[model samples]
Target: MAHHTLRLRVRRITPEAEGILSYELVASDGGRLPPFEAGSHLDVHVPGGFLRQYSLCNDPEDTRHRYVIAVQRDDHGRGGSRAMHELVREGDVLTTSYPRCDFPLLYARSYVLVAGGIGITPLLSMAYVLRRQRVPWHLHYCTRSPERTAFRSRLVSSFAGRVTFHHDQGDPSQGLDVKALLATRTGGTRLYCCGPAGLMRSVREAAILHQWPREKVHFEAFSAEATGAITDRADTEFQVVVRSTGATFPVPPGRTVLNVLRANGMRVPSDCEAGSCGTCLTRVLEGEPDHRDSFLPEPQRTTCRNMLVCVSRARSRKLVLDL
Candidate 1:
């Protein structure tokens, strides 16, 4: 789906935790903002020419004139979060895409929510919606310490017994036992997790060892990780054929399809170039695609009908795209 870009004025900025800042954005015209679901996120165009995605933590039931998002300042990141923390200010106008729910919550008998650090943002919204519907759900929030936890007071007041806190105090051995949690699965409990790479890896491994239904377990990765394709010495050169204009472009080993298309004057919308976001998805009419993106499910990837051009490549020498 396409996103609508709108200029929003920063209404307020407050510290959510040690390194996290919460920003409240409202329309410049003081109009009602677009409605978003519980797990929806916004692609924010920071002061720099880069875009970053942040989850909406506000209650979906309130169709107010504002949307709230939390950003954890990462100095070593792609500079989006740092720019937002350092340069953005209250009343400053910022452009953001309409809400996109990449990590949507489907119908489940119950949910076991697991979050690490700022990963709590999306799950917090899910908790609000589930509470409203009176659905059985529990949140297991893991952080380094209580001081590093965002929305601690709000969660404590709202969720009470349903929320459990796991603090490591900088010790991994003292952290929450993810393996134990996955091993003792309750009936009809759908799993949802978002966190650092290590935590996500542990969750995935546990789910695999315990034989959890793959379809019932969901997760989202924001940052790109090192894959074999990145450092592969056998990276092949390929050609892309645009079905619309019938123009062919050569894609080199180090270049991506999206970059090649953009260089050729094809303007395509993209938010996160890391392949986690499905914003730059394009249809593949021909050829087998070496799908590298984690956004598409296994069944969809096998079909090679749609691909994320940002990171995915073609296994065949020549491929046709529905551009």
Candidate 2:
């Protein structure tokens, strides 16, 4: 799929919480922007040539006028957040891909939203839509402290009775009881979770133990590290053959299929090279994949029809890809 880019001007930059900043983007020409849905994210081409994905937090209904995104500065990260915080300024022009959604909200009787830290970005948009539609839903936002919670005042004022704040104060044990909260499955209720890997994993396990339908649970990870793709496992050299071009490349240890393909002069549409985004998903014509991506559902991993080349590898000696 081809992604279109839009040049936008930074209209405002607000400090939402400690280490977090919310940026409001508008069309550079002072016109309406493209429409987007809840859970959609923008692929920001940050200064210094780094591409980072940020979820849209503002109401989707207002997307025609502007788009809002929150960025959490990670001093230890690969510098995307740092660039946005230290280099980006209000009124500067920025380039971003059209909004894309991987964690879209589905129709259900009610909803349970789980957010951890900056993961509240996408869920906040969902809250707006649910509220407008008069659906029954609740947001459980978990943060280290009240000072670190983004959109705190807005959430309290707008979602008053439907939002619960969980502050663990850096202690995991004092956090929300994910297991207990999901102990019972309600008919026609769906769960949407976006957060650190621990929280999402816990929600997945709890939903499974309580017999929640797999289709009823959804998740989106904030970073590649949260997906466990960057691991300590030793990698081995392998070969990949492109079915369309009949081109073969050797994927050596410590390098990803994406890197190899791009180095070989192949253009692949990708957003999050960490495998959290499904932008680089490629069909697998042959071979089993060492699936490391959190983007693929559990059932899809078993079928092995597709793979995220960014972080996944071949369990077989060779892979035939429908590139």
Candidate 3:
């Protein structure tokens, strides 16, 4: 899954509620693009010029238009959201990669969709796909307020009674009615959730407490993997040995190992640069990885032996990475 650079050409900004912005993009050739499934996401080049991922909320089948990504003005970070809000506009192109999604929904009999705030990006496509296929499902969308939600009217009118909207008036105490929702279980249903860390943690715990099958409980983290502190690495160029091609390259400074590989014409599949999604997980043959990602747990990461090369930097100077 190599990332393809695409340019955003047009945007429709709605500042009324939650600030919805629709982006129109085309491939490098400015032609019809390849097909993508529901829940597919692309690694978009952020405005300030770092790679961040965003899910495609538009209909996957519609190729005439590229995407409709909603960005809320996040007060955090060095201003990616603020730049997206202020700078990105019609005909002013920005670099975005082709679709690469980690959370592909395996076929299930029924689905219970849950979306929180900007977490609605992935689930909205799934909900639409389920309805188009006439699958048995329902969606629960929870946001801080109606003003903070992106597609409020569209969800209500189009989804009708199949969706439930819960607007919390900025109160942390007024949580979702999770106990009532999960009180009864659908025997053949798979629950899909993408939201804040708290929502995901709570949902997973309750689902496990209710004895939901480990396989049936599916989720995708909206945020990236947070590695605490990187080790004091030497100023030597690390060698990343490509497993498939049997080639080696010197790791560059001031750029991620992934960036070095991409610059060398290698199309490595990567979406979230934060290492949470396991998109860039590669086998580490010989060196000890200073593991710092959230996805790989102690019991499992002990076997990685496979390491995520995105944010997890090299421990040793001449360390090897399986591309």
Scored by TM-score, the top model is: 2
TM-score winner between 2 and 3, please give it. 2
Q: lDDT per model, in order?
A: 0.80, 0.85, 0.68
CA displacement after TM-score superposition, residue 144 of candidate 2 (Å): 0.6
Ranking by TM-score: 2, 1, 3
> Where's the lowest-lDDT run of ten residues in candidate 1?
224-233
**1 versus 3: better lDDT goes to:** 1
Per residue, candidate 2 scores C-alpha lDDT tens digits across 97-141 of 889887789999999999999999999999999999898899999
Query: What does candidate 1's lDDT look like per residue over 50-163, in tens digits?
Result: 556688998887647788999888766556677889999999998877887767889888899989889899999999999987878899999999999999999999999889
Q: Which stretches of candidate 2 lie over 4 Å from their true place?
A: 225-323
lDDT of 3 by residue, 55-172 (tens): 7787787756567666666655335566677877766766666676667777888889888878888898887888888888998888888888878888888889888888878774
Tell me the TM-score of model 2.
0.76
Judge candidate 1 at residue 27 and give its lDDT.
Answer: 92
